[model samples]
Each structure stands twice: as structure tokens, then as C-alpha cells.
Target: MSEIQKALVVHAEEAERIGLPHGGGFRLLADGRDTGGALGANRLSLGEGAAGARPHFHALSTELFHVLDGVVRFTLDGVTSIVAAGGLVSVPPGTPHSFGAAPGSAAELLVVLTPGVDRFGYFRALGRIQHGLGTFDDLLPASEQDRYDVHFV
Candidate 1:
């Protein structure tokens, strides 16, 4: 018999949420291991004026963001743009980018990393730092970030 494939389903109430320092949060949907390395996914909810992500790039995967609510501001390679709900952005590997809620607005986004990297640990680490249980420096080492494919510039 051949290997069996199973579907993965994450109900809204069942997703794990990770809180960020600025009142935002991440609802993890699936990690690489859960999807057999096809993709990792999460829903990011940003408070008004909250920073979603600082400038960074992935060396091994393309990151895609689909705006699920409100407006978001994105800085891609130093250029800034405003994306409203329903907008989608795909950043290729090695391209520097960052994002946040538009000033005075709250935003929600569905984020996906293709050719997936197991990023749940990174998200959990961020939550730890946000909660004062860990330091940002803990994630600065190459061994730490490399495992998630996220590189800070």
C-alpha cells in the first residue's frame, strides 16, 4: 500500500494564539511539519497603529500576506504602500519587507510561508519575549533564526 495523506483542519477556536508586545497577536494555523513542508500559515491581528513585523527577509521561502480586515501599511525594499482589506502581497525570497497596521487602524492578515519552514517555535519565542520571559537577543543568533528562515537586516 502507498502512503496515506490526511487533511488538516484548524477551527477558529482551536488555533493557538500568540500575543505580541504591541497588542497584536498571531493565530497559528499550521506549521511545516503539519503540512509536510508545503507551507506554514497563521493569522496576524494588529491593534491600531501596531507594528506587525520589523524589516526582515527569508532566504528559503516566499512569504505571502492576504489582508483579511482593515488597512495595512507595507514597506517593501524601502518603498511604502497602503493595502486595504482583500489586498494580497507576495514577497519573493531574499526581498526585504515589513508591515504594520495603518495609522489609527487595526488590521488582520493571513500570512503564509511557502516551501515551509517550521516557524511555530519562532512565534512562541516572540510571545515569550513579549511576555518578558525571554530577550530579543535570544533570537539573534544564526542558529535560532536559520531554523525559521527569517533573517533580520
Candidate 2:
């Protein structure tokens, strides 16, 4: 860990864990504020056939993914590729992209966004919706896209 990491690392128990079915949930490891806007990161564990991110673009941030287990299917721009454990992929700002666990496979991936945007609220809403505690309506208005940092394409 770098000096910055030593100061900012989010310990496992300290991390915010979001629940989901079949072990597909998110663990927020770090957010923009924690890293002083250097980056945002989280661990995503997905089950077979679990839906992942929809096509979206970060107008001002780059997104990265590192598969740690199983296979993940990433659709970058107009192409799709299956990345297995140990694979890494990075998408620059403005690139339309999406990702999910490959059909019939389970996966875990580390996701990071550079010059990070605070997306904890957005992700929390996702957990709520998935578990029936809330509706998609809870996310926010499209007009507030800049606030949440996700612009579905």
C-alpha cells in the first residue's frame, strides 16, 4: 500500500456490504471522498445470469474492471468479450459500456472509476431495488444525472 493507501484503505469489515440474491451483491471498498477524488472502487460478486451494469458512460471518468473469479462478459463500445479470472479491462470516459457475469457462471470483479464520482447512493438504491425495499424511482431524476455520475445510454 502506498502512503495514500495506508491512509485510505477501507478494511473488509469497515467496508459497506450491500446484499443481493445468490451472493450477487456489492461491497463498497472506497469512494471518492476516501481517496480525495483520486478514484472510487468496489467489489462486485455476481451469480449466474445475474444482470450487471447497463449501457452507460461516465462523461468525465474512466472505469476499470478486474475479474477475480469465474468469467465476466464485458461489452465495450460495440464489441463484447468474455474475460476470465485474472483479466482486466479499462474503459475511457465517454465510452458506452456494460458488464455482467457470463451465463452459467459466477464471478467477482473489482471496479474502479478514476477522478472518482461519489456513486454510493446510486449503488445503494440498486441494492434496495433488487431486494424489494425500494423502487427504481428511488434513484433520482435524469436531470440529476451529473450528481450521481451515471448516464445510462
Candidate 3:
């Protein structure tokens, strides 16, 4: 069967927002369906010391980050740097990378994943764990490899 395509629109108030465990909020802008698996986007707001994803890589997708406010500390291939507001960075598929809000400052950014992965469940599970509704181990089942394709490096 062929898939149908349609434009997706999301206003500020329409974003699906999720609070992170440590200190951050994520607003999902577009999912794989909306972009026809081409890309997905989320707006992230993190306080100082907020924990971001661990060092990992997407085997089949590129991750891009655009700093909208404050600074973010990004560790890419063992090198770390503070990306100030308005700065942009892109991690090619298979690159080892991690990121978080700067130690003494907060940050806001727009994160995009190209060749999108179906990660809404991952995002929701993260919020549930942060809110004490689920355990960290519950975030990733043995079948997660098939579901999200996340590779920890």
C-alpha cells in the first residue's frame, strides 16, 4: 500500500511538552509521520547542570542542534566545547556525541533528527521516569534496538 502525505502544522501551544528528569523540558514539534520519516524536531529548554543524552550515535540518522538561548556543552568524539546561543551543530550518523546545558548556565535549543526514527515512545518513557512513574530500566527493553535504533558509544 502506498503512504499518503500531508502537511503538519504545530503552533506553540500545540507542541507536546515533556519535562526531563534532571532539569529540562522538551517540546516535540514534529514526529516521523508528520515529516514522512524525513525528519523530526523538538525544542529543548534546560537549566544549568541539566543532563542530556549520553554519548551515543544514530546509525542511520543525523542529529542537528540549533542553540536558541544560553549555551550548551557538547562532547563530540572526545572533544568538548560550549556552543553559545545562535550556534548550530550537526552530528553525522555514527558519530559519538553527547550534550547538556552548560554547568553554570541554562540553554534552549531546537533539535532535529534527519531520516527520523520513531522515538515518541522513548521521549514519553523518559518523562515517565523523570516523574517517578517508571524506572530507568523500563525506558529501554531488550527490544529497544528494533524500536529506536539508538547505539550507545
Backbone clashes per model, in order? 0, 0, 0
Candidate number achieving the greatest TM-score relative to the actual structure: 1
Residues 49-109, candidate 2, lDDT per residue (tens digit)? 6778888888989999999999999999989999999999999989999988999999999
What digit string (tens of lDDT, one per residue) describes model 1 on residues 38-142? Answer: 899999999998888889999999999999999999999999999999999999999999999999999999999999879999999988988899988998999
Residue 45, model 1: Cα distance from true site in angstroms: 0.4
Deviation of model 2 at 100, angstroms: 0.6
lDDT of 3 at 13: 96
lDDT for each of the candidates?
A: 0.93, 0.87, 0.85
lDDT of candidate 2 vs native?
0.87
Q: Which residue pairs in model 2 clash with each other?
A: none
Q: Which TM-score value belongs to model 1?
A: 0.94
lDDT of 3 by residue, 35-66 (tens): 89989889988888787788888888899999
Better of 1 and 3 by TM-score: 1
Task: State every prediction's TM-score relative to the real structure.
Answer: 0.94, 0.91, 0.91
The list of candidate 2 runs beyond 4 A from truth reads 1-6
* Worst-scoring 10-residue span by lDDT in model 3: 138-147
Higher-scoring candidate on lDDT, 2 or 3: 2
